[model samples]
Target: MKAISYSRYGGPEVLEYGDLREPKVGPDSVLVKVRAAAVNPVDWKAREGYLDPVLDAVFPVVPGWDVAGVVVGLGASVTEYAVGDEVIGYVREDFLSRGTFAEYVGAPVRTLARKPRNLTWEEAAGLPLTGLTAYQVLVKALRVQRGETVLVHAAAGGVGSIAVQLARHLGARVIGTANERNHDYVRSLGGEPVTYGEGLAERVRGLAPEGVDAAFDTIGGDTLKVSAQLLVPEGRLVSIADGDVVSYGGRYSFVRPDADDLTRLAELAEQGVVSVHVFETFPLERAADAYRRNEEGGTRGKIVVTVAWDTAGPDA
Candidate 1:
C-alpha cells in the first residue's frame, strides 16, 4: 500500500511517499480503506522526535492520527461494523508504525466511530482528535458548568474552535484569545474574543471582572501562566500543550481514543451542535507539504491529506 513514512526523526523533509506492506488486522481491529487524514501539530512534532519521551517510534513510521474512511474488512472478533461501514478514528497506538496517512490502516474497534453523515470527508477526518480534545477537557477535566465564564486560548485553531461551540451548548459564556483578524471568527463560534499578548489579563478582566470560572489553555509558556491568573478562586484550568499546568493548580490532559466519546462527537456533528473547518487539504503524496503548512501555524482549522484511490490498485 502507498503511505507516507520516515526512517529517522527530522523535519518534513524526512517524509517519503512510497509503498509499505499492508497492515495485519488483529481480532479487535478492522482494515479501513483510507479516504482522508488530518494533520495535527503532533504529526509534525512526532516526526521531529518531540514526542519521543512518551511515544515509541518504530522506524519507517507512518505518521497521522485522525482519519475518515470506510471499513473494507472486519476483524474476526468484531461485530460492531460491517464491510461497507464509513468510519472516523483517532488511529493511534502506544507505538508509531502503521498510521492513518496511508492507503489503508488497521484501526482498533476501540478507536472507531461511525462517521457523521453530514460532514465532508475532510471535515470528518478533521474532527476526531481535535474534537475529542475539546470535549474531554471541557466535559471532564474542566467540569465546565452552565452560566460560567470560560476562556479558551487560540480560539480560531482546531481544538479551540470546537471548544467554543461545545461550551456555548453547555450554557457557558466563552472568552477566547485570538488575533485581531480572528475575533469575528471566534464570535461566530459563540465566543467573546480577546486579543492575546501584553495586556491579555486586562482584556479578559474587561469581559469578566469577577474573573473567569474556567480556562482552557492551548498555548503553553506565558499564555498558560496568564490563564492561571485569569481564573476566579478555585476556578478550573487544563492544558493539552504543556504538562507544567499541574504546577498552576491545573490538570494536564492528553486526549485518549474512546469509541463512546468519538460517537458522542459524531452525534453532535450530525445534529449541527458542532462542526469542523478544513483550513486546507493536500493529496496523499504531498503530505509533507501539509506538515509544512501545519508547522507554519496560524491556521484557522485542520489541514487534511486526501487519498485518491483507484479501482486499479494502491499505486494507481
Candidate 2:
C-alpha cells in the first residue's frame, strides 16, 4: 500500500508519500479501501503539533481524520456492515494511529456509518468531521431552537458551511460570517451573510437587532472574542476549532462524535435538507498543494484529498 506520512511534525513539507505495508484489522475494526479523504484545519493543526498533548502521537503520524470509502473487510464480530458497504466516518481524534491518508486504514465500527447515497465519493469524503462538528454544536451544545437567531462565524469555511445549513433546517434565522467574496455562497445556504473581520458585531447587530440566540465560532482568537458580543444574555457560544475552550461567559464546547448525531446528519443529507459542498479536490499525491490552498482561508467550502481507486492491490 502507498501512504502519506510524516516521521516528524512541522509543515506540509513533513508529509511524505511512499510505499507502506497494508493495515491489519483488529477484532472490532473495519478495513476500508480508501476512496477519498477530507482535509480539515485539524489536519494541518495536527501536522504542526498543535494536538500533541491531546493526541499524544509518536513520531511518523498520518494526518487525516475523514474517510469516505468502501469496506473491503471487517472484523469477525462486526454485524452492522459487510464487505463492499459504502461508508464515511470521523476517525477518533484522541488516538493517533495511521489515518485516512493511507491507501487502507482501520476504523472502529462505532464511528463509521453508511454513506449518504446522494453524495459522490469526494463530497462524502468532506462531510464526516466537519458535518459532525456542526451538528453537535448546533443541535446538542447550543440547543438551538426554532425562530431563534443563530450566528455562525467563518460560515463559508468547512464546518461553517454545514452549520449554516443545519441551523436553517432547524428553523433558526441563520446569519453567517465570511469575507465579501463568499457572501453570495453563504446566502445560498439559507443564511444572511455578513463579512467577517472588523466590526463583526455591528454587522451581525444590523441583521439581528434583537440579539443572537446562539453563536458557533469556527475561527477562534479574535473571532471567538467578537462572537461573544453577538449573543444575548446567557446565549450559547461554542468553539470547536480551538485547541482550548474559550471562556465567553456562555456555553463553550468541543465537538465529540456520537453515533446518534452522525445518523441525524446522514438523514438530513438523504432528505436533501442539507447539502455537502466540496470546493476542491486534490489527489493524495498533491496533498501539499491542498494544504497551501486551505491555508489561504478563502475557500467557499471544504477541501478534500481523493485517493485514487482506479488501481488497487499492489498492481498499480
Candidate 3:
C-alpha cells in the first residue's frame, strides 16, 4: 500500500511518499481503506518531535490521526462495524506508527464512529479531532450550560470554529476572538466576534458585561491570562494549547478518542447543529504540502488530504 512516512523526526521535509506494508488488524481493530485524512497542528508537531516524551514513535512513522474511510476488514472482536461501513476515526494508538496518512489504517474500535452521512468525506475527516477537542473541553471539562456566556479563543480556526458552533448549540451565548478579517466568520458560526490580542479581555467584557461563565482557549500564552481575568470568580477555563493553565486554576485539556463522543458529534453534524469547513485539500502524495499549509496557520477551517486509490497520478 502507498503511504507517507518518515524514518526520523524532523520537519515536513523528512516525509517520504512510497509503498509500505499494509497495517495489521488486531483483535480489537479494523483495517480501513483511507478515503481522506485531515491535517492537525499536532501532525506537524509530532513530526518535529515535540510529542516524543509522551508518544513513542517507531521509525518509518505514518503521521495522521483523523481519517474518514471505509472499513475493508475487521478484527474478530470488532462487532460495532463491518466491512463496507463508512467511518471516521481519531485513530491515535498508544504509540506513533501505522497512522491514517496511508492507504489503510488498523483502527481500534474505541476510535471509530459511523461517518456523518450529511458530510463530504473531507468534512468528515476534518471533524473527529477538532470536534472531539471542542466537545471534550466545553461539554466535559467546562460543563458549559445553556443561557450561560462562554468565550472561545481563536474562534475561527479549526477547533475554535467547532467550539463556537457547539457552544451555541448548547444554548450558550458565545463570544469568540479572531483577527479583524475573521470577525464576520466567527459571527456566522453564532459567536459574537471580538478582535483578539492586546485588549482581548476588555473586548470580551464589553460583549458579556456581566462576565463570561467559562472560557475555552485554543491559542495559549497570555490568552490564558486574559481568560482568567474575563471569567467570573469561579468560572471554568480550559486550554488545549497550554499546560500552565493549571496555575490559573484552569484545566488543560487533551483530546482523546471515544466512540460515544464521536457518535454524538456525528449526530450534531447530521442535525445541522455544527458543520466542518474545509479550507483546502491536497492529494495524499502531497501531504507534505498540507502540513506546510497548516503550519502557515490562520486558516479559517480544516485542511484535508484526499486519497485516490484507483490511479497512479498525484491525485491518487
Candidate 4:
C-alpha cells in the first residue's frame, strides 16, 4: 500500500511517501481503505519523538489517527461493520505504527464509528479525535452544566471549535479565545469571543464578572494558568496540552477511543448540532506538507490528507 512513514524520529524531512506492506486484519480489527485522513498536532508530535516515552515506535511508523474511509475487510470477531460501509476512526494503537496515513489501516472495532452523512469525507476525517477530545473533557472531566459560563482556550482551533459547539449544546455559555481575526469565527460557533494573550483572565471576567463555572484549556502553559485564574470557586478545569493542570486543581485528560462516544459525536454532526470546518486538504503524497501546516499552528479547523488511488501522482 502507498503511505507516508518515517523510519526515524525527526522533522518533516523524515516523512517518506512511498509503498509499504499491507496490514493484516486482526480478530478485533477491520481493514479500512483510506479515503481521507486528518493531520493532527499529535501526528507531527509523534513524528518528532515527543510521544517517545509513552508509545514505543516500531520504526517505519505510519503516522495518523483520524480517518474517514470504507471498510474493505473485517476481522473474524467483528460484526459491527462489513465491506462497503463508510466509517471514521481514531485508529490509534498502543505504539507508533499501523496508522491511518496509509492506503489501508487495520482499525480496532473500538475506534470505529459510522461516518456522519452530513460531513464530506475530508470533514468526517477531522471529527473523531478532536470531537472525542472536546466531548470527553466537557462531559466527563469538566461536567459543564446548563446555564454555566465556560472558558475555552484556542476556541477556533480543531478541538476548541468543537468544544464551543458541544458546550453550547450542553447549555453552557462559552467564551472562546482566538486572535482578533477569528473572533467572528468563534461567535459563529456559539461562543463569545475573547482575544487571548495578556489580560486574558480580565477579558473572561468582563464576560462573566464572577468567573466561569468551567474551563477547557487546549493551549496549556500560560493559557492554562489564565484559565485557572478565571474559574469560579470549585469550578472545573481540564487540559489536554499539559499534565501540570493537576497542580491547579484541574484534571489533565487524554482522548480515548470509545465507539459509543464517537457514535454520539457522529449523531451530533448529523443533527447539525456540531460541524467540522475543513480549513485545508492535501493529497496523500503531500502528507509532509500537511504535517508542516499543522505544526505551523493557528489552524481554524482541520488540515486533511486525501487518498485517491486513481488520481495520485508521483511524490514531490
Segments of candidate 4 deviating more than 4 angstroms: 309-316
| RMSD of each candidate relative to the true structure | 1.2, 1.7, 2.3, 2.5
What's the lDDT for candidate 2? 0.83
Local accuracy of candidate 1 as per-residue lDDT tens digits, 56-150: 99989999999999988889999999988999999989988888999999999999999999999999999999999999999999999999999
Tens digit of lDDT per residue, candidate 4, span 190-287?
Answer: 99999977888888888899999998988899998888888888899899999999999999999999999999999999999999999999999999
- Give each model a TM-score: 0.98, 0.95, 0.97, 0.97
The residue ranges of model 2 lying beyond 4 angstroms of the native Cα positions read 242-246, 311-316
Backbone clash count for every predicted candidate, in the order shown:
0, 0, 0, 0
Instruction: Please give, for residues 1-316, the per-residue lDDT of candidate 2 as tens digits.
Output: 8888888878888888888777778888889989999888878887888888777875567778899998888888898889889989887757666788888888888778889999999888888888988888898789899999999988888888999999999999999988898988998999999886787788888988878989887777888777777778878888875533446665556666566677778888999987888898999988888988898788878888988785455334
Whole-model Cα lDDT per candidate? 0.94, 0.83, 0.92, 0.92
Candidate 3 lDDT by residue in tens digits, 115-169: 9999999999999999999999989999999999999988999999999999999
Identify the runs in model 3 with alpha carbons over 4 angstroms from their true place: 311-316
Question: Which candidate number would show the highest TM-score if scored against the true structure?
Answer: 1
Worst lDDT 10-window in candidate 1: 307-316
Candidate that scores best on lDDT: 1
